[model samples]
Target: MATTPDTPVAKALRRELLLVTGMSGAGRSTVGNALEDLGWYVVDNLPPQMLRPLVDLSRHTGDSIPRVAAVVDIRGGRLFADVQAALESLRDTDDTRLLFLDATDAVLVRRFENVRRPHPLQGDGTLLDGISAERARMAELRSQADIVIDTSELNIHQLATLVQEQFAEEDEPTTRVTVLSFGYKYGLPSDADHVADCRFLPNPFWVPELKELTGLDDVVADYVLGLPGAGEFIDGYVAALRPVFDGYGRENKRHATIALGCTGGKHRSVAIAEELGRRLSALPGIAVSVKHRDLGRE
Candidate 1:
C-alpha cells in the first residue's frame, strides 16, 4: 500500500474541529450563531457517524471552511454513544475541542416551560425527570469537556457576547471576564467562579431619590462607591484576583465569571460590578464586560 502524504486541506482540517454539545435548552443555537458570526462553518444536529464524512467534505472545499463546529446532542437517541468514539478518533489527527453548555435544572425547566415543549427524554414523566436522565447520560461527556459554560444566569445577549469573546479573532485578549451584578433574592449565578456580596454597603433602594435611578446614573454610582470600605474592597478584590487570572491563563481557561450581589441588582451590586469591570479592563491582557442580571426585576 502506498502512503499518501498530508496535503494542505488535511493540514487545515487538523487545525480546528470543535464539537459543541450540552443540555438541550442550554443555548446551543445561540452558540452556533455566534460561531457563525465569528467565521466558523457550523453544522447543526449532525449525527456522530456523519462527522468524519463532513470533515472529509470540508477538506475538499479547501480553506473556505477553515474552522468547523458541529452541534451534537442527546436528540440522536442511541446513536449519541457513537459521539465519544468519533471524538476519540478525531483526537489522533485533529486539534479537537469539546465545548459543553450547561445550566441549572431550575433554569432549564423554566426555559422548557417558556417554549412549551417537552424534553426529548421526558417520555411520560415530568420535565425534571427528563432533565435528570439527560444529565446522568451526559455526565461523562461533561467531565471530558475542554470548556464548560454555565448559562443559568445569562440572558441571550450575554450568552452571545460570551461566545463571541471566546471565538473571536486571535488578536483579542486570551482571557475574557464577565462581571455580573445579580440580586441575592433572585439566587446566585450558578456559573460564577467568584462572588462578592455588596450588602455591606448601604441599600440605595431606601434612598427615595436614588431608588428611582440605577447604578448607571452618576448620582447612584457615586453614592455606592463613596461608602466607607467600598473603594478599598474593590481594590483588594482586584488585587486578589490577579493570581487567579494568571492561573487561568496558565491553565488555558478562556473565560471567567465574577458575580456581585446585593439586596437588589439595581444599585449597589451593579455599581460595584461596573467599577470592578472598569478596573479590570484597564489591566493588560484581559477583556472585561459588565452585566446587571436583575437590574429591572424590581
Candidate 2:
C-alpha cells in the first residue's frame, strides 16, 4: 500500500540509516546488540538489496520502529558486492551512515581461534589467507565508513560501552583515547597510534624496596614521576598531541591508542601512562582511559 508522505509512521522513520559492518570477528554482533540496547531496531545479516524495503517496512509500521540499524558483513558472500549499489541509493541523502569495526590481524586471528571456528572465507587455506581476502574485499567499504573503530585491545564489555558512548546521545560523539602501558620485551601494542618510551628513567626494580610494587602504588608512582626529565616528557608529549588530535578531527578518527613502554610495565611505563591518561582526559571533547597491558605478566 502506498502511504502519504505526511503519515505519522513515515515521519517517525525519517531518521538516518546506520549500517554496522567490518571484519568477520570484529564484534559486529556485539555492536548490533549495543544498538538494540539503545532502543534501535536492529537487523543482522540483512541482504543488501532488502535495505530500502527494510526502511519501507519501518516507515509503514507506525512509530513502533523509528530507528533501524543493520549489520552486514562477508557472510553474504557474492551478495556483498551489491552493497555498493544498495548504498548508492542512500548517498544522495545525509541520512546514511556507516560504522566500521576492525581489529589488528593478530587480534582477529586470536578471536577466531578462541571461538574454535574457521574464518568465514578461509576455505582450505590458512587463517591468515582468509583474513587477507576479507580485508581486501572490505577495503573499499572501510574507506567509506563514517566511523572506524580499531578493536585490537578492547574486550566485549569495553567495546559495548564505547558503542553506547557514541550512539547514546544525539549531540556529538566523543573521541576516546586509550593510553596503554607495556614492556618492551613483550613487543609493541599492535594497535597503538602513538608510542613513547619511558626507559630513560632508572629501573625501580633495582631499588629493592620498590621491586615488588607496581605503578599504581603511590610510592612507585611518586618515584617515577620525581625522576629527572619525567615531568618534562609528560608535558611535552601532551602538548604535542594537540596537533595530532586536530589531525584526527580533520580525518574524523574518534579512537586513538597511545602506548608507553619501559623495561618492564610494572613501574615507569605504567606511571607515565597514567599521567598521560590524566592529561589527555582534560582535553575538551575527548575521553581517556589507561590500561597496563603487561602489568602483572611478570
Candidate 3:
C-alpha cells in the first residue's frame, strides 16, 4: 500500500516540533534565539499557515531539521487562524511539543520601551491599545500552552539556562556552552543561561593597580580570588549545582547555562565565571565555553 501524508513514517521523521507563540512584547525572540543557540533550526515570524507544510516538508527532506522552532505570531496577517490549526495538528502527532512564552503587561511594556520597537498591532492605534488587542488575540493560544513563561522575573542568564535545561544536544557528549559574565551596571547580558551575582566578593576595581585590568588578567584574578568568602562560596555553590548536573547527565539534558554576575562584571563575576567553566569542563564528559560580557568594556 502506498504511504499517505498521514503515514507513520512521515510522522516518525518529525523528531521535535516547537510552536513558538506569545504576546507581542514578551520574550519570544529571546526564546527563539536561545533555542537557536542550542542547535535548533529556528524560523522566526513564520506564517501560521505554513507551519504544517513546513513540518511536512522537513520530514520529506529526510528530516533536515530534527529540532525545529517556528514563530507563528500576529505578523501572519489573516493567516493567524492557521497557527491555531497547526498547533492542533501537532498535538495529535507523536514526538511534538508546544511551548508558549508570556509575561505581565508591565514587563511587556518595559521590553517594548527598551527595544524601541513598535508592537505588531501598533500601526492601527495607541501602543497600549495594540498591546491589549495582541493579548486578547493570544488568549486562546496561551491557554493551550504546554509551557508558559513569565519573563518579567527572569534575567537573561536565567532565561537562557532554562532554555538549555529543556533543549540541548540530547545525545551529544560535546556541546558548545556559552558562559556570559555581565555587569549589573551595563544592563545584564541579554543572552545568559545561568547568572550568578558576585557583588558580595571583594572588588578588584578598588585596587588602583588592578582597577585597569579585567578578571581575565592574572592580577585581577588573583585579587578577586583572595576574597574572604571566595573559597567557601565556590565550594557550597558547586555542591548545590552538582545534583542538577547529575540529573541533567542521567536524563541526557542537552543544553544548559550557568551565569555568574557581580557589580562591575569586570572582576568578581568574570573570575567566578572563568572558574566555573574550568570546573565544569573538567567533568568526565560534556563541553564548555566562556565569555565575559563586561571584560573588554570599562
Best by lDDT: 1
TM-score, model 1 to reference: 0.54
The most accurate candidate by TM-score is 3
Candidate 2 residue spans exceeding 4 A from truth = 1-13, 170-298
Q: Of models 1 and 2, which has the larger TM-score? A: 1
What are the per-residue Cα lDDT tens digits for candidate 1 across 1-298? 3333476544434557899999999999989987876678999999999999988887788778868999999999888889999988887755689999999999999999999999999999999999999999999999999999999999876787788668776665657899999999999999999999999998999999988899999999999999999999999999999889977765546689999999878999999999999999988769899999999986
Ranking by lDDT: 1, 2, 3
Q: How does residue 225 of candidate 1 score in lDDT?
A: 96
Model 3 ranges with Cα > 4 A deviation? 1-14, 169-285, 288-298
Better of 2 and 3 by lDDT: 2
Arranged by TM-score, best first: 3, 1, 2
Candidate 2 lDDT score relative to the true structure: 0.87
True-structure RMSD, every candidate: 13.1, 13.1, 11.0
TM-score of 3: 0.56
Error of 2 at 96 (Å): 1.2
TM-score of each: 0.54, 0.53, 0.56
The regions of model 1 sitting more than 4 angstroms off are: 1-14, 171-298
